[model samples]
Target: MSDAQRICLGAIAGAFGVKGELRLKSFTSEPEDIAAYGPLESEDGALSFEITLTGQSGKGALIARLSGVNTKEQADALRGVRLYADRGRLPALPDDEFYHADLIGLEVFDTGGAPLGRVKAVLNHGAGDLLEIHAPGMTASVLMPFTREAVPTVDLTSGRIVADPPEGLF
Candidate 1:
């Protein structure tokens, strides 16, 4: 029932051409595989879409058509909506890999067990995922590199992360 358990696959960028085609921005590693996960639901779980990839576009994004969307206006209307899939449908990750959703709510702590913060989000702007941790008593959130050196341990079952943050990052 918790929407937090789902992984965002992509988003509906609204209708592409006038023939009901959609502009889909895939968030998957293999961009074209967005359709392979089957129907994706809206964040609020209010709507579901069945996507069929038609072809690729200029920016590594795909032009697709959805089951119910058929017009450029319709596609444009859905421009910024994010799409999500059931967590179970996603492929299993390697031992050292993890989905961003799995780390979002994990408690962050120092090597000495001092509470630091909770993960607010994971950001990846080409290099790698960064853990955005939000802690009490701090005016601003901290952006910690999610690498093995900085975040040494991520125990999902325990809902906690042990971070060896850089000096002054605390």
Candidate 2:
């Protein structure tokens, strides 16, 4: 399936125990909700599995079992494997909210309509989301806060963002 049709919901952190249980880091608003999206597929769509949440790890990650995964070695092999759910299976967000997948690749512009860059990624480091922008002719990308003041508008239909970055942050 195309990436635009899927939404990455979690990743396997490695084997949780000697069993086939996996340490899953969920990217959903409610961690447990990751399992509610039906079967998930790998990034390349090479593999697909239905997840069963068995428990929660000490670190708050979900402990899950994939349909065919058995034994620690099997789970270990899936370490770092990202899980993607079909976009249609996910709950729709309010107009102000967006899935990170939808934000990536969107064109960014200044309030005056000057082109800034395209969104390279959306990231969060325990604080809030930041939009990584890849501007033309720049060796390094810029990280702009994804806040109301910094990003005044996100037009999904137009595939564009209107950023009002903080002082000196282009």
The residue-by-residue lDDT of candidate 1 on 61-136, one tens digit each, is: 7999877887778778888899999988999999788888888989999999999999999988778889999999
What residue pairs clash in candidate 2, if any at all?
none
lDDT per residue for candidate 2 within 79-144, as digits (tens), equals 999999989999989989899999999999999999999999999887999999999989999999
Q: After superposition, how far is residue 32 of candidate 1 from its true place, in Å?
A: 1.8
| Residue 108, candidate 1: C-alpha displacement in angstroms | 0.8
lDDT for predicted candidate 2 compared with the true structure:
0.93
Q: Each candidate: how many clashes?
A: 3, 0
Superposed model 2: Cα runs more than 4 Å off: none
Q: Which candidate number maximizes TM-score?
A: 2
Q: All candidates' lDDT scores?
A: 0.87, 0.93
- List of clashing residue pairs for candidate 1: 14-75, 15-75, 20-70
